[model samples]
Target: MSTLAPPRPSPRTTASAGLRGPARLVVRQHRRAFQLLILLTALTAAGLVAVALWAGHDADVFARTGCRVDTVTTDACTRSTRAYDDSQYRLNHSLSVVALLTAVLSAAYGAFMAGPALARELESGTHRLAWTQSVSPARWLTAKLAVPAALTVACTLVLTTVCTWFSTRGTLHPLYWHDTSVYGTTGVYPFAQALCGLALGTLAGLLLRRAFAAMALAAAAQGIAVHVLQNVRGHLWPVVHGPYALARSNPFPRDAWMTEVGYLTGTGERLPMGTCFPIRGKFGDCLDSLGVTRRYADYHPKSHYWPLQLVESGILLAVAALAVYAAHRLLRRLHA
Candidate 1:
């Protein structure tokens, strides 16, 4: 008698088989949400690419005309500059809106995770049914957190990368780097903020166990956290201090973030900037008469961009970790 060999699994079957019970359940339950997210992400990506191309073309036109703001005074230079400025403004404004939308989406994600993902199950006693059927509460919670966390991270990375590319290459706009709207979407900040939202939402779900309440709390918490972080971001890194005299003609380095510019007394006391003002007079004479030894500026140079981004990201990530830990502890207590 010929023994039948076991049937070989197809690629689809093999892939499906790899997903465990909790993972499978989580994916199935959130499939619609995932689909929506993917669609939105794809649309955003396409728009960004289009903006990049348009901005790039405008930049090329400006470059080809050899337009220098300080020297070029020809009609071609004037037209090129005007066209480039308009393009830059449009693209930069669009990107800034996208950056703001990222934060809003983060809040929405948090609310959804808190309400539909975890809190609904708890509130409806569905979690208990799952727990009875081979799935532990911890495993269920893990799946809930892990799936969204993974998706959030991937989406954040892609958007951040696109924004960075647009800001650096597509537009010749200076100081776009330090703008609040641009800063949020570039570098590691987006990822950190996204993770913070996910973690906080999970914690809210575990603590409240009421879908609507959890969602509300999570969103409120996210708003507060974002506000605080935005205000404190400039202080996270040491600013480069330069004499105001040298900086008078060209304050701060090219594209640097000027945090403060003020008068400095010979005794090293910092005075308000008004002491040297009334621009009609000779600046040196005005300063000498006012006993202002020099003017100084505290600024973050372009080189410090990465450092500031990383520092802020680190703080956000730490907050996320704490939220995650608190969520786990809350889950354990409820189960006990």
Candidate 2:
């Protein structure tokens, strides 16, 4: 007896039966999460900009600086005073607002971005839909991954630009001392490094396989490490090589650095504090004090900004990438 030949799938039938391509699937999968993130980001950005404009020239970024001027060095005091007096407080205040929004955005994205997609896929077995389709598991993951990474990079670049502009004003001294964001010159703390934080958060989500858990891990890890490292690198480590040295002979340590004011102690007569006077070092080491006869002197520390940021961000991002790779491998192996 003759057997009937098996029917082959027609292009139309195949197309109708098959799953959509990876790109479309990725979008479909993450549409809700993306919408929420976009809404949150837009609202945050608008609020910050509005507040900055409304509060224009009235913010107190410089008020604290003015208070410290009398006892600090000339340039530091003068710059701080002029910054306050010039009514340029808007720029510095704007930065603080921007920094806050950036941090919140990073944390929000980190907490939910990867977890929403990955955890549900694993738990619901919907991942099998794509896994059995034309799309490789790798491509499926890549498309989903690319969206948040792109969003994070764009946001971070914008924040960094704003931070640099705000930092140039010299009025946000206390904010910098406290916040310590790696995004700008003054702020320390690893969490201040928005790009690194976002990337690490994504990786954390992948590793923990739970949205809230991953977010908490990312926030705590980045927040604590960045804060601690910022201080150590800025104050203790020679991460940024300033133009001037902190040698004892330099007579303008306080003027050079308000932070160094307490460290000032003259070898000779405790030259009346707050007066610029000549100090005799050695035969040819004569230097005039800019109201400082002892303690460490400094030049502009702005130059050190890029290098330290590079190192700190680099390290955090590297760790994040590794974590993500490990998680991906583990998931693949478990599936196998």
Candidate 3:
């Protein structure tokens, strides 16, 4: 059990002397998969850049024809915009699909961790080859994690930056910002989510030690975690409460992600606007009749984006750390 815990000097040793063999071993073992990972990253980044440039060119061409994307349709504007509109529609649809794919990337990472990174080695008894060598379990696990973690982090960082830049640059496009897909694809959260998935899946594999079962457990558990996080996301941050002025309220700043809209009482209790249904009187009269002290709009302004992202990333990273610690402890116990 003591040997399961790396020596105090192991960190420096591992960084310099210990890792060279194991890291190369792990990469060689997964050479095809590793190569595929690199190839996909390069292709995806290049393709996204090309698409953005092409879309920008199309938009500029449409603008040259004297049309605006947001304005009411005139005959000439309508005729000219048909091609541009089609292209934009397809692009937005693709964006949504890509976002959905990005959200599930964590699940894929988890599955890979369980199925290949740990379980396959264990099931095939190949891990013993490393453990039987100068490599300790800690170093073996570190080698396994470090390579994939680096690749996953770099992959998400590049994709997120590209997607965010493209999405924000286009004024005619709407912010899908509040959507889980959009949020998943555009920030630090995606990589954090992937890291958490890897850790949790590695832990699961360490526990189960069977390839298929561990893969299923890891994928399902991580997927559910991501879904739950998205569902409870609105509560993660304190929402900005509204101008009691409602319609006349200074109006939410552009791109604010509104979470709730309703009326409030003097006690600050919320009531839906429908609660004041009027048979004949105006909406204002109905509100007055109900003693509605003020209207409420619970929202997250655009400024909250980074704050929310950072907070969520913090949570995911914390969980990842715990999972890795548990994996470390479990591996020690198993090898003891």
Write candidate 1's Cα lDDT for 1-336 as tens digits.
999999999978865554377787888999999888878877887798898788888888778887875675888888778888888877877788788889998898889889999899889988887788667677778888899888888888888888777676543564357887678888888888888989999999889999999999999999999899888878999988888663357555567888887888788888877765666658777777667766788988878879989998898889989998888888888796
Q: Which window of ten consecutive residues has the lowest lDDT sum in model 2?
A: 253-262
Evaluation by lDDT, superior candidate among 1 and 3: 1
Off-target runs (Cα >4 Å) in candidate 1 are: 1-19, 59-83, 170-172, 246-248, 276-290
Question: Which regions in candidate 3 have their CA more than 4 angstroms from the true location?
Answer: 1-15, 69-76, 176-181, 246-250, 277-286
| RMSD each, Å | 4.5, 10.1, 6.2
lDDT of each: 0.83, 0.54, 0.80
- The all-Cα superposition gives candidate 3 an RMSD in Å to the true structure of 6.2
Model 2 lDDT per residue over 72-153, tens place: 5677677766655444455556666666666566556555544565654555577788787676666666666666666656
The model with the greatest TM-score is: 3
Identify the runs in model 2 with alpha carbons over 4 angstroms from their true place: 1-20, 43-91, 166-195, 235-294, 297-300
**What order do you get sorting by TM-score, best first?**
3, 1, 2
Better of 1 and 3 by TM-score: 3
